[model samples]
Target: MKLRLTAAALLFPLLCGAAAPQGAPGEKMRTEKVLRMFLSTSETGLDPAVASDNATLSLLENLFDPLLRYDYLARPAKLRPNTAAAMPEVSADGLSYTFRIRPGILFTPDPAFKGARREVTAQDYVYSIKRLYDPTLKSPWAYMFEGKIAGDETLRKRYGPDVPVAGLQALERYTLRIRLNAPDNNFLFYLATAATGVVAREVIEAYPGQAGNHPVGTGPFMLGDWKRSDRIVLLANPDSTAVFHATPGHNAEDRALAAALEGKRLPRVDRVEVKIAEEFQGRMLGFLNAEYDYLEQIPESMTDMVVRDGRLKPELAARGIVLSRFPVLQTYYMWMNMNDPVVGGYGKDKVALRRAISMAYNNAEDIALLKKGFAIKAESPLPPNVLGYDPSYRSPVPYDPALANALLDRHGYSRRDPDGFRRAPDGKALTLTMHSEATVGGRLRDELWRKCLNAIGLRVVFKSDKKTEIIKASRLGTVQMFESNWIADFPDGDNFYQLLYGPNAGRANYARFDLPAYNLRYEQARRLSDGPERQKLYFEMNQLIHAYNPWVPLTHVLSGDLRHPWLKNYKRHPVEFTAWRYLDVDVAERARSARGRGGNR
Candidate 1:
């Protein structure tokens, strides 16, 4: 098979003469299996410590190893040790954890290895955790480990250029230990995320400024070729120790999948090619013409055509096109910059203004107008299937423009300008500026926002830019407002609640909502395990968020996974990206069915 490359695609100068993996030698050689995928946006980078985008994390899953990982086909997902010899031993107080690293696991051949097969060690895991708090890295995920570890203060106050985390340690060459200052029920789930993926120390020094482009790890795949925003290819690591056994599942679907893949060697596919396309039309048409094997997150425009009543249309279904619809573990909301002068402050008048804005925006109407009635209005801060999600909890602020107008009039914002827009108490002009995507859909969404705010006598404006730039600005605390959507890093309510943690201002807390009362409650909830006590704390926090209106909680959107017939054993994980190693692709069947255009060169 000839590997084609776009003009932008360039061979990585860092690695050469690397051995490509062959899973089951003879029979696997008869058919070249390849999985083709697409991304709507370009990756931020491949450096796990610094990268936060979805595209980069998805690629990192196959290129690196975590101490643990979620079981393949488990419903209500279960954890299994990956690089760890077994599950960590937790102390009775839950403040201490110890793990044993698996021996003889070899990192992929790289120039930085100095002509030796480098084995992953306990210190490597320790180093990876430290990198998350490395001041130089400025990782967005630092919120997860902040103040939770026993000696985290040392990490934050470090003057050295290097990342030295005193809270994490290697008791032996194969034994790792972590001591927490407080108990965290979701700590294991954090260990399984790609942000905690292990990396070789020598490799980090070898690449210097280019570490994100050059990746080396003990996983099933190695980075083969990359073209920045154009394309990326992953070649299987021949020396990987990954193997497949029967997976325990909850339903008949799990039973069937387990039977089909009992003793198969991992990475049944030879290579995975991910293409980045900016336009949904080209991607949708490519899938329609069988140019790509599977399409994840099908846009609503494409969904309307292929789906009639939330299921795949019969004509496409007959062609063996499978549509897997699931509730995405995410929440989309407009985050108000609590630090901005116009909206900031804990005073009654400021809170009233923010609450009025929240009351005027109709979440259900937004879904109907933009999402084509596909998404569900979010009632709880946590999305579905997460621990501590309260299905019975309802928002205190409902959609009511009259009440919004009344609230504004009761406050100092009753004075109307010549244009009928309300003026600030000091008689200064008041305008809300929001950042949005520079596209047709973005314009339509902005127009609706304008209408909603205008009806309540609030002046609103929109700023358009690339999503990446907007995210950067938001992180820097410059953007006053933006349509922010958060996907669960793991299946837990802790992940959602941490978004407003006061100390996490520049990290996960984009709202920059720093209130001493809310911070104390979040800390209290983190220490207690899931129960009525924790539930009560979370409920109080939700009520405070509603009263303060730091965020106008919106919708939990829908996700549609579309795949062709030849891609077998495909199941979508709720909290993580696609697990490519366990998937099997039938090249001959795909070629014979169509023009051999899907997933293969």
Candidate 2:
């Protein structure tokens, strides 16, 4: 079946080159030196202080630079200095950190600069960190530094906007000193995240309350044009002097990738144009028609057509298309709102109900039938690549329909109504309402949910809506149960545990799970260094989550990206938000390939 384009896709003409005058064939085929891609949904905004979605975070990563970044090809990801001169100097107590800014870093030219060279200084970072604490902004990232920074809590309580934070200080023009309330080994990793990407104070002040739309920073790309939901354009910063430096790789594949990317000035493309294509079919058609250089996330429905026997299909391969796969630090799960009256309780019956539901849903079948074997059945919340993940840890909630039915029967749900659905203890019809998106894959998952729930003598009702609508409903606590995933902001177990932490309720904790013992263990684990002790704590937390069943851990997806062969040095970073700087596109080669493949649609 041919894909249908949405009205939004139809509105923007797919133009990769400038049109030459009437009879000039050679000039008509001129390449634009641009990288074209698609965003599944419109970006919420680009302000690092408030942007939380993947689309916004990805854009912000290129628009701003953090002090440190994750090594592109490392397996167990390592932190490296980006804007910092070197790794921070740590005090013996581990509570104090001192870093010096790399010289010659300048923000992209903007009105905020006021005709002066806006070089990045240590104070810029100090001010950027302070913005997270601004009460009016209410940055979602505030959780990262909440109690860790020594005096931040007090400053947050008393300050409104642009107040000086006591825990952070600019000791010199290039030097920054940060004092934390306690020792945290994972603190450096936190700084490496896109959430901490430094923004210039002048820019924030110039566009007060609108920095999300008007971003200015010292990164490889600057915002060229933005049309809200239609499109976004990023132009390579002419003033950027960032170069790709090689790192010693742990394996042969890493070494080869590093060698190919070494010493190249970023970003290789002159411009990046991102078009909004909300439908999977539209995105797939765009990629196949040579309108896009890369397909970032391949739709599950088209996975078989694109990839055959773990490789690109013959026709696509002959057209110089290549597939790259990487195991991401992400997990998709179904979360039950523990705050809901039907699902929330500490009693045996409540726990049994949740566990039975978890058991009834077959994650293995979902991976095989829906994901097409592109995912690993998740056993724990901490995915494979993270520090605290345990390979031997097995989920207590296995797929067992008989066990599920028996559990429900024992819990006083044995009575059946006229529809053959179970009745509650009070003789009311037992029905569950789940929120899902109105996408193809969503419909398939909802069907499976209905099948599984019906097998356990419960009727399931699905409320289908758009992706943003589902997210808004879930965040407002209006969703009783929902399917969601968390992509790690930093490669740490604490990042995952925060989703279940009571303090993060209504924010990251979509499940609204509030178990004091689990919360206590989560807090204890955060304070401990990464070692056997911390892994033990992680295991304990996993066991608690398994018993409580707030979220039935589903699958850890293996992300696949298909790109034109001319897109060189494209390696995936498991933790890093942006890696466009390391990528180079061969515009001539792409044009030649497109011509050989019978030209663009």
Candidate 3:
């Protein structure tokens, strides 16, 4: 069923909630309804250090709160205090960061924990960061903060076969100092992720094996119960001061950031419940049927239908749900494995081959066929929306098969065998394995990719696997060329720059391309305080990416979520924190007052 509906028809029904069988208004009126969420995978674990997948982190966000949170509408990537008393002090070089701990911040005890019920302290932060790097923990992300924190090597050496960890330290009771080997401006943003949220050290010690399952945080919601495949419940924190509301007189962005840091009430919602739904299509259908109060990962198909039909504005109004949209700094690219001989046939001439391969396909057509007008085609690794994207600069290659063929010929790939396959100068047929995740649009991509390669006399053997399988293959260096996308953990250029760094560099570098000059500038860009200097470094680094071409940049993925109209106070920030927080959710005030909280469970 083509979900192509006219906008006017969709909005017309929103004028009356009764017209739509199931709407946001009807769902919100129910007291104890569970919010059904669709996730592609069964959550691996809740440990922030090892939590790599987005799906699992999304659920964990409700159970944790970071020291500083992002104010999306604020300027220059606003950093508002959560557990901190004020903004952190960043050294002139951006290496040292000191924060004054907020007084009276308590860490609630988990039901599974045998620890004493008490408030969290700076010691917990010290222990938490150090624990992840402990050799005994075997945390994959222990290296993420490698050069940033002190004692990393000592900890690793001490715990080599026992329990090594080196990065974290506790200076004083309320004041903490963190020293980094190098400067990273976005380090504050990294601390904002739910996976990095602070936890009580006692909680971890009490139930060492069950820490992930039974979590605790200072967020407005407490982790009540989390059952794999059944349901996840977030009970309201009785002592939580989060009151989601805009300041009455504060209109300017700066004023709001100031107010947020002052510990003003933010969210209005009391509780949040998430029911796991694995099937993506089922989640979309159920959302349209209004079975959920709010659906975080909106079905892409339904978003397209609403956009084409123009029913979003009216449907949301009639149902009392709010619609919000923003651009996210996320890019989808194809990673070419240089380690494999057959796929890496171009070897030393990899840059020329990468440039040629980049020009073979029309990114615009790919978006039309795969993304359906939801995404923007990207020519550079850094999109124009990013801080230092150079608009005047352009890549050497263009979208032309003739040009692609010419580049190949220039690079000693001139021969085309009888079967019309490109061969190396040695008369060996060059073949590559193109790997892709089996998503909703995978089949379409398979057909489109085949056509693009055929035009350039290149034969591609496509392997489509589940998302997890594809990621594992890329990390293991088993795939030649594969599809991947990265959403910035924080709104900074380094997040993208570090991904293409040397082998086993950061979170997203699976292909492991190492360029010393590139890494040097990447480090400098993070440290340089001058705006112009940072811009220059970032621009130079990005241009080098085009010259090197380890990964072919494609397009920025457009993300959206569908919610019933009655689901109010729900909003999403652009970069950084994309998941919905329970604080913004406002139960129907009138309905709640009338029912007197005596309705359903």
> What's the TM-score of each model vs. the native?
0.91, 0.91, 0.80
In candidate 1, what residue range of length 10 has the lowest lDDT sum? 8-17
Regions of model 2 farther than 4 Å from truth: 1-32, 161-164, 248-257
lDDT of 2 by residue, 445-481 (tens): 8988888888898888999887766776776788888
Q: Per-residue lDDT for 513 in model 1?
A: 96
Best by lDDT: 1
lDDT of 1: 0.81
Sorted by lDDT (best first), the order is: 1, 2, 3
Distance from true location, Cα of 446 in model 1, Å? 1.9
Q: Give the higher-TM-score candidate: 1 or 3.
A: 1
lDDT for model 3 comes to: 0.62
Q: Tell how far residue 580 is off in model 3, in angstroms.
A: 3.3
Score candidate 1 by TM-score against the native. Answer: 0.91
